[model samples]
Target: MARAETRTHPDTADAALLEGGRVGLSGRWTADQGAAVEDAAARIAGSAAGAPILVDLSQVSRLDTLGAWVLERTRAEIEAAGGRLAYAGAAPEHRILLSEVKLRAAEPAPAPRGRLYGFLEDLGKRVVGAKSDLVTGLAFFGEVVTACIRVAARPGTFRGTALVNQIEQVAFRGVPIIVLISFLVGGIVAQQGIFQLQRFGAQSFVVNLIGLLILRELGVLLTSIMVAGRSGSAFTAEIGSMRMREEVDALRVMGLDPIEILIVPRILALVIGLPILTFLASLAALAGGGLTASLYGGMTVDAFLARLQAAVSLHHVAVGLIKAPFMALIIGIIATIEGFAVEGSAESLGRHVTASVVKSIFMVIVLDGLFAVFFAAIDF
Candidate 1:
């Protein structure tokens, strides 16, 4: 094996090769030599002005994949510049190896990954527009309520069965999952509270912590998540499908108020249902927390119940229940607006359904944050 050496030839093959570092593989030219060879080649290519360079690999001790790749790249750069690079002084044993190993240099990837900033800016604009639609839909809900009052008084104006079915689907089928989530949340709160209060020898206060937080925050948050997944998406899909089928047009043609006959009842049902569900959720959460505390936290069920009584205020329960109707109204209006905005197509339906769920959940979270700030400020 021969160590590689550099020698600049005075009489070279081309005018391009006459400048500096024209054509020699530097250092030990072998598989392990790595970038030393490539660096030498790059230096040679960069030294001349629009000149061809021939690389002398004759003294190479060994040729490996890396050495071959570097040579191939150098050759490419030379050819790209309308210049030439030639191989010279190869060992007989290197013939078969060099022939077997070829380097395919990767093409440079294109720039601009579809203007990400512009795409996000456009998305932000659409989100602002969608929230505006939510506010407008909320205002429109007043007219819907008025229409509902008239329809309820008349009782003969709408399809009661269909409306009742929708309400049941929203409220009834959702109870088990709601109960499970609220119960787990209550258990988690109990664990945290026990850990904190145990420092003061007040482990039994876990019940109070669970009761207060669950009734106030967790109950509303969980219910909102549920409605976002369940009723909100359903609202979008229902109204979107109605739009797709032109049933909304049929209702308009019949001189019936779509707001009254179609939208209002659903919104009213959610408003009515959410608070009822929250109250049930509070009970279930308390039970779950009490059970966990009694079993693991060295608290008796009677003691847990007693402390729960002392810690949770009727005011807190009322506050949470109050928030539910507002949350429900927000979800209802947002979902309904997205549904109505859906164009008459299946793809649009899917898109709007996803949008409705997302918007409803976001609005619920924002509203919850506002509630937290306001209530915390007022000590509610």
Candidate 2:
């Protein structure tokens, strides 16, 4: 104990300091005393660098987290400046709290990751995500094939009620819109052909373009696209909602395969329904083309009918109709896969539903292109 000199703080919080690097804290050092405590700690740290300092808290009748933090901060600053500090005469509880605070305060924050590294990491994750989606799609496709085979072997296992219901929903209900859209498309094609051919005085050829295009490509393609957006999206939302409500899980628990019960009926319906819808859509489009040619292109109905009847071969009709079931298969696969992928959240349901429609539309277009190339190479 060297000769001690007393330094008293103007605030009641600090009380005084003694000689030989000793400081005394007093009174309630709560959040109310925050500013005064930090000020006193800073002064001591500035003057006592590399010196042995002792803190006397015997007079501190009360302490809280705020005051404990202040003292810990002072100790940290002193140690950083090459000084040694100690707490003496502290309560057991306070010592524990101060030690914990100091431990927490000393931990370093995580450094920021580099931008290039972040970009590479994100790209890798996306690639992995894309691969996962592809694998899931293929697995679902396989499940559909297996289920269809089983149904084929045991015809009694087929759910006719479910199949008919799905057909009514996905095909019958969709017929009006399909007819309207296909008619408009046919009329637009006829109008455009007439407009372009009028310059060459070959306006009679408008009937040929309308008939050939409607039968060979636009008929099936447009109908499939519409079905994918309308019915395909509905299928996803329906199954996804069932999945979210745990109905699909209940089917599994009851010893029934969800794929066979839920998916097969829809696939069967689409396969059976799309070709019929495609044919009706083709007829509607041809009717529109004939109307447009008669009214706009000034071609008589007989002439248009004769030209259309001559221009459209049965092979053209077969090509369009043949692609229908395949496109339906693609749409069904995409929609069902996305539906089963839904998580237990409304957000997940919405996202998967959107993904279903988008993926179905994209696949439908891709399949159309593939069909075009195949047909062209075979000179169909």
Candidate 3:
């Protein structure tokens, strides 16, 4: 027979090799033993080394959860290394503790994906999501139009106060920042134009560039983007909060059409307010361009005004204004759609609000690009 190997830990714990590959454990086996119990368990696992072994626990004076967990983990490690572990002579309480601490094996890690495969997977998901969003947006738009028709048929259902309130929120209060930003942008464009054109002795043409660009594209585009970020986000957050609190369901119970009461006024306000804002923003940009021309391009204010008057046509102004209501409708629809998607959590509300702003801005830009192509094609 092989000489018995023994590892002892005074009164705390001990592991002793016995006859027939049996490991005898003794003394207190509890949290109080701490490192001694851990050390003994580790020794048993290492010595087993893919061999069959039986752990005898009858000699144990006390056993607790920590001791049981350590023993179970050691057994798991031994079994994973192709060894067999069995407990024998365990007291009833010790057997129960061991059963409770028999932890399940951890799941295996996933295989690493190739970069191209990962990219394709992500792209496919985004394309599918975009398709779904487009279909949902169209359905919501139809609902909004239906609501508008209902309100038009019964003028008494129109919420004039709500419309006025939204106009104040979306247009009047937004004027200061919109004007300031448009002014700065126009001034920068004028300064750059003067710098580029002076090299060719055609600095006076910068006035035509500023007038056409601001009236035809930049003015309404900038205003719409700002409104999407400001008012659109507000719409989503307001409605998302109401959704979280179940007020939307309450409206249905009360026989009130949520779309007519909640969304129509907001969309109508955007339709009315955006064009007025576009006009104001264009004027502000023109003023800024004139100031920059006088200061940097060696042109007097009166001369700049004369050049602007001669360069810009009503057709250019009409192009910018015509895009406003469409962009407004897009923003309002996207905002309300995301609002109604919110779940009963703050995280969902915030996520949908952000998505509303991002989607609105992206769609606004796409719509503008499409309009640009159509206008170019038709010679508008």
Superior by lDDT: candidate 1 or candidate 2: 2
- Say what the RMSD of model 1 is: 14.4
The deviation in Å at residue 302 for candidate 3 is 3.1
In terms of TM-score, which candidate is strongest? 3
Q: Model 1: runs farther than 4 Å from truth?
A: 1-131, 152-163, 196-200
Worst 10 residues of 1 by lDDT: 10-19
Better of 1 and 3 by TM-score: 3
lDDT by residue (tens digit), candidate 2, 110-172: 789999989999999988987997898888889889988998899998888999999999889
Model 3 lowest lDDT segment of ten = 1-10
Model 2 local distance difference test score: 0.86
Record all residue pairs in model 3 with backbone atoms less than 3 Å apart, i.e. clashing: none
Candidate 3 structure quality by residue, lDDT tens digits, 314-349: 999999999999999999999999999999999999
> For model 1, how does the per-residue alpha-carbon lDDT over 314-363 read when each residue is reduced to its tens digit?
89998889899999998888888888888977999999999889878888
All-Cα superposition RMSD per candidate: 14.4, 5.9, 5.1
Quote model 1's TM-score: 0.64
The best-first sequence of candidates by TM-score reads 3, 2, 1
The lDDT of each candidate is 0.76, 0.86, 0.93
Colliding pairs, model 2: none
